[model samples]
Target: MKKNIVVTGGTGRFGNHLKSISTKHKLFFPTKNQFNILNFNSMLKYFNKTKPDIVIHLAGFSRPMELHEKDINKSINLNIIGTANVTMACSQKNIKLIYFSTNYVYPGINGNYNEDDPLKPFNNYAWSKLGGECSVKLYKNSLILRVCMTEKPFIHKKAFANVKTSFMYHDEVAKILFKLLNKQGIINIGGKAQYIYNFAKKENKKVKKIYQNKNMKIKVPFDSTINIKKLQKIVKVKF
Candidate 1:
């Protein structure tokens, strides 16, 4: 059955792909001016107008992981507080909420993390995302997807050979998202777990190899791969 779906941050990288794939539902991608997550009144006002059945909460701070450190306040306000506002608005209307979180919430030391696994955010960026997760967890009618996805064409020239992760392209994940809308709680969403170099080389053979070393300013996870067995059971697609 078709339903009304509102996507926050619909203009963003992942949102842009999601908008392209979501044809079955009455989707609304509200701009910041139209539906600001930071302002509950704005969110509520938009929700009241759209009367959506579900809200895909994707509005948050991401990228250039260092930004989280440089501006902790911005990170907290946008990612944590902004998500909290969204969650509250969704809860008030009893709308199903789907949150896009990151796989970095899990301890990178061990790969193959499941929904039940203990969380240990690798960096401040991950911590802020996890903070958002706290509010979503409180809402019963919600789904949290700890996704590990990247843009197509592999933006980085040098890929880490040792660091392992379940990196799926944004377009790939977007194709499978609608199938998991009814899912509740947390689910690990990504492609086959492999070395960053291998994942990159598949798309760009010319991609150079690099290593994660102590000299690096950012804390790179050695192994942040997620187990998608639960996800496989939900969707027909194999990833």
Candidate 2:
């Protein structure tokens, strides 16, 4: 079945990879002019005109984790309020929604956090993402993906050896996305649990291993790996 799908934030890093994938469904990567998530009228107008079957809400504030701390208003408005607006539009139009969340929603102390596990966002950015999750959770036709994926080729020169996480490349996750389109509810999406350096070294052999020492400015999660058994059972996806 070739369904009409609308993807927000089509210009972002992961969105770019998702756009390149070969899927059976019809994907619409709308520019901000066509669909501005922060504005309810614009989102609703676009939804009414396009009449898409699925809305993948990817437009939100992310990266430079410091930005969230430095400017809380930007974080709350973009990630939280923007997502709520998308959810409202999707709910009104009776469209299926797939939200892109983060694995940082889980407590960093314990590894292998499940979907039902208690959520304790380790950073302000995670808090904003969780706030977005709250709105989508209310919509029955929504699917929340707590993904722990990163950019390909390992852009960073220094990798955290002491910090462990389930890091999958953008393309790997994009490949398995179409399979999960019809699914609803929360799901942990990630790769096998491993140290950051181990995953980075696979692509960049010269990547330096650096532990989060006392001098480190930012707070990095020690262990934020999620339990992806449910995702494996659902899609049989391999990273």
Candidate 3:
């Protein structure tokens, strides 16, 4: 059956990929003006207008990890508070909420982390995402996706040799999203566990190799690979 779906960050990287492939569902990718996640009134108004059965909450601050540290207020408002507002609005209307979280929520020391693993965010960015997860978890009708995805064309010139992760391209993830919508609770989404360099080389053979350094300015996870057995059972797609 077809249902109305509202994607909050519909104009973002992953959201754009979803729009390109979405043909079966009635999806509404409203801008911040149309559906401001930070404002409960705005969210309620939009939800009332659209009467969506599902709302994919993707509006949040991400990238340039340093920004989270530099401007904690922005991170708190957008990633934390904004998510809370969305969750509250969804709960009020009894709408299924799909939240996009990060694999960084797990302690990066161990690889193959599962959905049930205890969370310990490595950085400020991860912490903010976890904050979002807290609200969504309180809402019964919600799905939290601890995803490790990146854009296609592998923009990075030098990939980490020592670090391991399960990074899937946005376009690849977009294909399997519909199967995941009906799922509740947390689900780890990404590709097979492998060295970051190995994954990058598959897409860009010319990509150089680099190693994670302790002295590095940014916090790099040595092993943030996530186990996706649960996701595999549902979608039957090789990550």
**Candidate 2 residue-wise lDDT, 152-205, digit = tens:** 899999999989999999998888788899999999999989999999998999
Q: For model 3, how many clashes? A: 0
lDDT of 1 by residue, 40-145 (tens): 9999999999999999999999988989989999999999999999999999999999999999999988899999999999999999999999999999999999
Give the range where candidate 1 is weakest over 10 consecutive residues by summed lDDT. Answer: 211-220
Deviation from native of the Cα of residue 55 in model 2, angstroms: 0.4
Error of 1 at 21 (Å): 1.1
Which pairs in model 1 have colliding backbones? none
Candidate 2 has a TM-score of 0.97
Worst lDDT run of 10 residues, candidate 2, spans 212-221
Estimate the lDDT of model 2: 0.92
Score residue 239 of candidate 1 by CA lDDT. Answer: 39
TM-score for each of the candidates: 0.97, 0.97, 0.97
- lDDT for each residue of candidate 3 in 1-239, tens digit (9 for 90 to 100): 79899999999989999988856789999998989887789899999999999999889899899899899999999999999999999999999999999999999888899999888998999999999999999998999999999889898999999999999999988887888888899999999899989999998999999887867764678999999999999888574
lDDT of 3: 0.92
